[model samples]
Target: MNAPYADPSVTAKTVSARISPIGGLDVLSRNEVARLRGASGSGLHALLRRCALAVLTSGNISDDPRAILEQYPDFDIQVLQQDRGMKIELSNAPAQAFVDGQIIRGINELLVAVVRDIVYVSTQLEQIGFDLDASAALTQSVFEILRNARILKPQVDPNLVVCWGGHSISREEYDYTKLVGYQLGLRGLDICTGCGPGAMKGPMKGATISHAKQRRRHNRYIGITEPGIIAAESPNPIVNHLVIMPDIEKRLEAFVRLGHGIIVFPGGVGTAEEILYLLGILLHPDNASTPFPLIFTGPRQSAAYFEQIDRFLRLSLGDEVARHYQIVVDNPETVARMMIKGLEKVRHNRLDTKDAFFFNWALQIPLEFQQPFRPTHEAMRALQIYHERPRHELAADLRRAFSGIVAGNVKEEGIQAIEQHGPFAIDGDADIMRALDKLLQAFVDQHRMKLPGGTAYVPCYRVLSA
Candidate 1:
């Protein structure tokens, strides 16, 4: 499955022009522009370049983040302050981002998002003294990021569906996601996702047809991603609203907090990490009764994929962990129907509990889940994954383990770490380790871990039996 348009000879084309901001971002202070253009270590230029490139090359199929940079090595972006507003200038940008010498409207909007989030997180959060390390403080940061992006609508009902799945997935699985999205869209539900391709793109693609058919105005297709993973899994073209969180932890928190419900399609380690993250939070005593609908679904061919996932979850987290989620096989209509009913319950529960519909204020995410887990060699080995700890706590560690694997698999930093330090070693209870090893092996065997036509995926971590 080589990218249909891949050609090393297709060198990047340089474009230098000033473009006005779209949406709410119209102005930036001179200090902000300096920070964006600053070459110092603290500058936002590098971050801006990576994210802007990702949005410009929205439909790129490569999982290697470095590939894009290498292809467009001369690419650069800068923020220019003007009397009326701010303008963004691109150098050596991808030609695909434009049509007839003008940038596409969607790409322009996404580019603005790239600048907005980077500036806000770097300046406002730091200046306001937000404690990103504390759990409550971190959740507040996530909320503020979403609110600033105008993603949190006060009057909107609980209709935002967060779709999670692998960027690399079978065509059948992708099609199945579109079907589910169609059904969800027909019911007037908006979509949110990690904002990559495959399953993430499927539902949005499906929903657009339904949205058009229903003549639905102002439909939202939101995409949330972090800096580390965004380059590898670039934003899909359909995402109308895009927000880049500072890190993976905050990105995951943003999804669960902002989305009314979650629909998981077939995915690899990253998807497993997401499932564990949510289940960990839901299993916490405070969230036990919360009505957050969780569904794992795919086409009939993907039944075994979910089965393996179910087995792994039950084995490591215990059988009761199954109670938190439902599995729907090959039934797009039922999946959508069930989600509508689930969202209805969520709406009622929010009303009863006095929680905000746009954000799940009542869900309690422990500090362990919110704190960033840097996958250094020592940190990966120190994770406590035994039966003695609380179920939710163990789930957090398990989630971290998968998160590290995801980093090693596709993320640029993770790949560099593996290249320099070797594979990460994950140690846990013997039975749990074995189950984890088996599950990961399945992902590798099925080619779920990398792009469909890429070279063989080398293991990035080892599971040690206790």
Candidate 2:
């Protein structure tokens, strides 16, 4: 017997490259650069190195977070201070990021984004008196991160559509995402996503074609990612504006806060986690009257997949959960039409409420949904998944449950913990556990838990019997 073949490890390639920053990220102070280069143990340099490697490996197919690190074990990045501006020095980088000894333009820009956001968040946002524990303060932190990244447009209409789905998806489902994106682009709407592959990449790819056909200029293909997931799911090539939030909670907040509407395609646990997060917020009493368009869409073949999702939501969160989102299957045109109508409603809602189009300030996100969820074995086992609590509260815990499973599946820390302590134990109400087990098993049966054509996926969790 032979071991499975892993991706070829990245041999150290040294390169000293000077490139101009894109999209208003050209200037930085000496203090920021020094912090970026701080020692691996005490400073942001390790985070910066891992994230920079992920950006440089954009468009990669692997889902293992440590795959890049193992390949480029010696790879390191430095922020070189120059008289005029700044430069990046790469010692032992992935050769794929370069072509004939010159770095690819898009990859270079994304690498710069990794540095820019890491520095800004570590020095300015964290050092400032921003409170991550409070809802309003957390939302303010999200706004500051976006404003610093230059993604917010003050005068633009409600057009940025945030696409959410699994990075691991089928061929048919991936194509459906592009078709929906094409329709949205034809209507002149920009796009935002988790900034990885599969459904996340599909809409941007589709919209680019439509934008080209319409000859529309200044289209925004924005991507929002976090540190833990970026290493496994590298940024896709189509993202013109890339922003790295500090954690999964802030990353999700950035999406809802920045986009006018949301489109969800077929996906696995990660997608389910996203759906629950949005529903939990929308189900809040304070947010009952707010209007934000959310649609679950896929090709005709995925009708069953969406049906399973619908059943799980109705069963776990109650039947009324259907009110917050719509399910449209097999009709890209209709999906686009309904989204346009929904966007109009969103526009009028913003106008009537005096909210900004670039960011949704009125949406009330509870502190539970705003705080970062660390998915440890104890955390996974401690989740209260019964229906005795408020529906919104139940939804929040359920969201955390799936979020833990997601971490165990691909996140570096989660994977290592699982390796050391065995699979995470998830104890909940018997019926709820049954529903969750069924849904997750279905994901495995359909090969949604891991990237296609890779190694078979073993369960990362144990559902405790009632």
Clash count, predicted structure 2 = 1
Clashing residue pairs found in predicted model 1: none
lDDT of each: 0.90, 0.87
Give the top-scoring candidate (TM-score): 1
What TM-score fits each model?
0.96, 0.95
| Candidate 2, 1-466: lDDT as tens digits | 1011223443335343445454456767877877788843446999999999999888998889998899877877888777766777776677677776677878877887888789888878867888667789999999999998888899988999999998988899989899999999999989999999999999999999999999999999999999999999999999988999999999999989998889999999999999999999999999999998999989989999999999999998889989888999899999999999999999999999999999999999999998888998888888988879898899899899889988998899999999999998988788888989999999999988998787779889998863
Give the Å shift of residue 32 in candidate 1: 0.5
The per-residue C-alpha lDDT of model 1 at residue 338 equals: 96
Clashing pairs in 2: 10-71
RMSD of each: 3.9, 4.8
Q: Which stretches of candidate 1 lie over 4 Å from their true place?
A: 1-14, 39-41
